[model samples]
Target chain A: MSARELPLLFIRHAVAEDSHVLGDEARALTPEGRAAFRHHARKLARLTPLRGIITSPLVRAVQTAELLAEAFGVSGVEVHPALLPQRGAHKRIVDLGRERGAGWALVGHNPSLERAAIRALEHELPDKLRKGAALALHPLKNGGFTLAWWATPGKPVKRPGDLR
Target chain B: MSARELPLLFIRHAVAEDSHVLGDEARALTPEGRAAFRHHARKLARLTPLRGIITSPLVRAVQTAELLAEAFGVSGVEVHPALLPQRGAHKRIVDLGRERGAGWALVGHNPSLERAAIRALEHELPDKLRKGAALALHPLKNGGFTLAWWATPGKPVKRPGDLR
Candidate 1:
């Protein structure tokens, strides 16, 4: 990690079944989604070791967090209701990170997480959050976040120069 | 493609030899870069057929563009001097796309391409352009561009519903 940079990993859950069948918040990862997310977890483990993971209490997010914790040998993921599909929850995650003085992986839903990205990094994304996609943000000395790199599930881990 | 969207695929060049040995614009892709780019080209071929590819005159960009053209069976890539490391070049690529009324793949360098992404999509990515990362931008009906998707050289091609 660079001296002036603080890294934050924001991940969206992998694919889930139709929301109509199960309630929106209760949906779980599909078999393929699970398999792909495991790949993401492995890729992530190769990249950086997470000091902490804060995730939504929602089923899918928790599931994603669990896989990450298992992959990185973290104690466990901490569930935060603030990570639920709501506005400004990103702030809470950031607050948690600042309090811990360490990096964190935040797993949550779309639009809101994107919003949190915009608020934290002050940039817009081209589309909605893709299932199993992650954005790595690094804090700037100017008090804003800069996009460090991004990855998608089912993708292989990249080499040093492969990431910006 | 959506009626309201004009797709733009922005690609960075593959790995290159250090500038110390060759002139910056003349540096060629490394063997590893060529192999990785072939994979990316195949991935792009599977995604969508490009109406046109406009690339920087820089050796690396041209090399990357040639690989894309070969993979997609396009006749050839057009050289765009505007794509050379400079300010506001992304706009030129967008202008060309608007003029053609079709999707175009722009091959160029970083910071410049990343700036173009910011100018065209109004989004901030986490880091500098990776050696062969591509961002898909779709122009919205309301004006401005949205990132439809993104891919890296080593990452796998995603299936529908794989991204939530």
Candidate 2:
């Protein structure tokens, strides 16, 4: 696919503490979460490089986006309020990704990010978008998107053979 | 996912010669095709281990299935007439996969394999199933399957970090 036709990557933030004394938004990525996503980001960069990351302002989401940005070698991370956990934020998140064009990763929470993906593909995913996992949605020329690929953390990542 | 809930992988045959004077069914994988799919099969095995491979009786499809079976370490390659490149073969291909349960890869020609995936997910894919690529369909509890992940040949296959 051409650069313009690249899929929009929806990334759910990594694991976090069960509760935050301050609030949910203030909760940050646990050490394990940060380490896990740092690994996943590199694997993801191979499949599709990123231009930049658009992320929820929440602490955990921002942390996740930072790891992704580092792996993709992109410097900027645009924090969007729409990615904050809320009802119907999926529509705006998709709109933002479309506006930003291809090669953009959206980092956010579960239900909303997953909902956006399900809405775009018009199919219910058998597995939940796990922590530190990403789903790619390829844009169709006639409008709408198709589920392209998914990358989940903790899978083996060794090359089978010399493809080149 | 459980062993039973594992996705059914749909694999399009690797590159083949333009035509075989003998017949379409007689056409086999090119040397390059065999090498390329050998590499892809190993990468795929890391994601989902295959118990067995079911393929179209067509020569190219059977060859592709052999490479996959080797990598997955499965002994049997079941040749099924249902995977033939005929109109409406998609339904039968899916039924066979469902009957066989999970961890099975279906090797076949395009259009039919692609159609089977589209029918299962109920969505049109943005891109055609490229040669030497695999699309996974995760089974749901209620009924039907969901698009899980995709693996394409010729991409870089390095882990970004020490994920373990």
Candidate 3:
């Protein structure tokens, strides 16, 4: 594809606060989670210049969008509850995707991510929520999203006797 | 890149407690921060399945790496001062990156990340480092590192205010 027709980034939120420690609406990213978040924030600047940032208003999503916006030198983001994946969430994003032309990221929680990643983009997925994972979705000129790239947070170097 | 060669993930540390609010070393990720971490931790699991974790002994790095270990299903990360950035940090990671041949993730700070990301992997940077950012490096048989992906934590993602 030409640089003119790039892809949209569908990023899963990075790490978040413990579910038990905080309510779904209030949970945030842990300290290490912050590192995990920054790791990617810096990394993204290296790949392609991002467009606009969007995410669920849920604490985790807001946090993710906020940090990303700050990094690429932006003011704020447009929050879309439709990205949340709750009941009736799909209709919101689906309709939005159809109407919107191009260049945007959709940030949200899982089950929705799992559904969108596999069903919409066709990327192989393991489970519902793969925190901090991102799928590049290109809404084709003809309609429908395309899978460009996928990334999960960290990977460990395995040594001898490493428990597989 | 081929299926045979595995890549590694190295993340930048999360934001510490507001510098004015807590001791620099004793700081931790705020409530909002934890949510971001969890979001990404889940994302890491779907990829290569982390084998081991590594980080500095500082409360922040340990805290960040720990969350990821749990999410990735690893017990905990082993620490090495050599990984710490305060004292000749870049040289240490350069040596460490040279020694590494497996899929691994190291949580540390930056500008050390620039050393780790640029020296270990071949990439063209697009922006600056904010609080939480990430970079992915996949080494080639020819000994060059490939910048697989990069991300920032916040809004106005790219230059034009879209998800390019």
Candidate 4:
């Protein structure tokens, strides 16, 4: 009913190992991280109908996107190097979502995910999202987007009643 | 032990009715909102030991802060006009926390809370917080602050194993 064209979900990868033994890119999600993702994925599917999934090439991010793809019944997930934490690929990712003409989920790293959101909405963030947390954004008629809601893993959503 | 000083928590009032017939400032938390707040207050108490509680004079905010004070076993809570949704009182509040040499919780309205976080960290936020959500910020060395964590009402806290 609203002019909001598409919805964007920016999610950070789940927990992973600390040792850079295999290099940061090679590190994967821990057992707990994987289990926790599965738990949260169910709730996410109920809240949003994910049409497409995109993620960074990093092992942990790839793994997180795959789980989401499975949960959302999307056949495949794409990997884009731009989703890496330090990359300046935020605008490109946002453009991709706008072109898709449907809701898409992007799994990436912190700072980057935080920055991407900042870029889209041009609003200030209080902090980097916790691992596995996601922010739902809707594109405004203007070039920017508005944050519709923020979900931290395992927490119920709360919105201000009269403040809006 | 590190250079990080006191952490500041910015929280919104719990659920409230949509009508402004009573005037926005006079509206109170709904029964469900009150119960939900009680549920979250317990979790907040376990996570951090708040040394001081500050709130807006608004009825909903005062109620929310009172619940937090009781849960954290803090003796009393104070009201600061700066916490109202439209004030530029963030720096003063930060100074207050630093002077006190302890972690303090600020409960207030949106836009202002969002603006304060953006000003302090100079980072863009994806969206204004929903009622009952909180962001934890740790000050940076050269002034300003870094977003440490963001917590939504129902999500279980999950941290990356190695990072934690």
Candidate 5:
């Protein structure tokens, strides 16, 4: 948000069922899942200065990504399949991230989401990310990004809210 | 959810603001607004089986309306301004409780929402309503509606893990 700081934020998809049974496309958030996003969004927005959001195309991921995008006032969400857990998906995502550049956010599936976050952090995965969790990182000039602190959804350890 | 309980659910639009400066067509959800809707959707879905959804044609209302419809497998969200909040100088609303003639889920704006909810109860008012609050009315054998419950959106709630 400030010229002094480079922008970056990491966010996970909302709760989703395991694959093979539902097929990602058929999946939709359960009522509780949607609400959880809302709850965390308020907290995320309060803690960070986010520019844009990139997310997976699947419904739950797309919807979850949009929650943070909306909270940050981003114009619209762009789809990136690489953020998916599927193998061989990151190529497109990396390309998309480069084109979009720094100061943006990534909203996507699990492992991929953590991977992208680490890639931004120069290849260091934060502790495991839970659904609806948001990790904010700062891309440093010396190469590799700085850990801006990975915060759980709904409320951060550093920032207090209704949850606390 | 049970055959004996026959429930009706109403979902409120998330954070939205009407600007005197802009025309109605241009108004849309604030970033926080969209988050609010997406946030609560999960919980609302859990409250009932989420059979159907109906909405007003207004853009902001409709956008917020679609999220709920999509989350619940509402199958379709019918747009009808008959449920809309009157524009600029007009402030009257139709009580669809008697007209709609049965239990249904509706998504729309204030006063109108309250009027619709109360019509099933007592059919009068200057009433009090808040953002993202919902109520249900049961249709009696005598063709009157009785108030079931009123629910207010909780700021932070959970997202759906999967549609069960």
Candidate 6:
């Protein structure tokens, strides 16, 4: 695939224990979430090769990133502060992806990940990225990006090879 | 699923003979295109139940819609002028879907279909809708819609059941 076809995978952390059960930042993925996302990540890896994973420092996001690292066979996950569930972290995430020249899976939270995709495509997207959902953004020659596809837990994987 | 979850599936007609081979309006799907799209439609039907198919009057589009009608087990196809590959047809298409309520699959040509989706979501989307690609727009309670998913020929099918 061409460099332009390389994608920035925006992934939302998987299901976690209720915030009331633990402090919000310290919450981690439930056992089921880990297993489900591990399977989903493997399916995703079959579709597109990931160079590495960038994730939030939060436990849930970090755990999600680690699963992706395992699935994609990347050595380690890079924790970034910008991925904190903030309002405007989308810009920094996109910049980080561009700086790395794409093919990176970004493990983060909702709203921000959704916003990053919308901003990149300049169009409205699925309002919510369910826990453990991954949205692919393919770079354009003009510095813009387009929605490549979206994969969520339990959804049948669409193979990109059919397009060839 | 709630009524709001019903989707308006925007499907681009499968590949057709080059416009030069025949008049643009009369162009038909090549044998390969027809066979490929038939398989794609069957996979899509397994994902979402389509109430019916609305198609462009153009031959390629009608053929594509017919396959959807077959896969979906919808009685017939509705050919509409608004899907004629013209500028600003997106509005009419969305109106038709709303008028009939959601759960309809729309088969048409690109640019207009792509624009219709962008207009509905109010965000940039994939710049192109490859032949036989179906984009699902799930309605929101606010009378708007969110992208559910996108399916293209040759991609492994993502099962919505997994989301449950």
Best by lDDT: 2
Please give the TM-score of chain B in predicted model 3.
0.79
Per-residue lDDT over B50-86 for candidate 6, one digit per residue giving the tens place of the 0 to 100 score: 7767777555676577567657766545556677777
Q: Deviation in angstroms for A115 in model 3? A: 0.9
Q: In candidate 2, which residue ranges exceed 4 Å CA deviation? A: A1-164, B156-164
Per-residue error at B111 for model 2, in Å?
Answer: 0.8
Docking class of 2: incorrect
* Residue-wise C-alpha lDDT for candidate 6, range A37-88, written one tens digit per residue: 8789888988888777777765567557756765776653555666878878
How does candidate 4 score on lDDT? 0.68
Cα lDDT of model 3 by residue, B42-129, tens digit: 6655555655666664445655665666567664355655566675686677566556645677778877766656666544355555
Q: Write candidate 2's Cα lDDT for B1-164 as tens digits.
A: 57876778899999987775546754656667767788899888888777777777555665577567657766555556677799889998888877876788888887888888888878887467899889888877656887777777886432213111
Q: Per-residue alpha-carbon lDDT of model 4 for A1-164, expressed as tens digits?
A: 32344467888888876743436764556657766776788778887787677777665675576567546766545555467566667776667556553478888887777777777777776455889987878866666677777777777743323114
Q: For candidate 4, what is the DockQ?
A: 0.01
Q: How many steric clashes between backbone atoms does each model show?
A: 8, 0, 76, 14, 21, 16
lDDT of each: 0.67, 0.74, 0.60, 0.68, 0.57, 0.73
lDDT of 1 by residue, B1-164 (tens): 55335467888988876762324754656657767787788987887777767777555665577567657766435555557787777777666545543377888887778777777766576445688888777766555676677778887543324444
Q: What is the TM-score of chain A alone in each candidate?
A: 0.82, 0.90, 0.79, 0.86, 0.78, 0.89
Q: What is the TM-score of chain B alone in each candidate?
A: 0.84, 0.90, 0.79, 0.83, 0.73, 0.89
For all predictions, the C-alpha RMSD in Å is 22.0, 23.3, 17.9, 21.9, 12.5, 22.6
Worst 10 residues of 5 chain B by lDDT: B155-164
Candidate 2 TM-score on chain B: 0.90
Comparing 3 and 6 on TM-score, the stronger one:
6
| Candidate 4 chain A weakest lDDT stretch, 10 residues | A155-164
| DockQ of all models, two decimals each | 0.01, 0.01, 0.02, 0.01, 0.04, 0.01
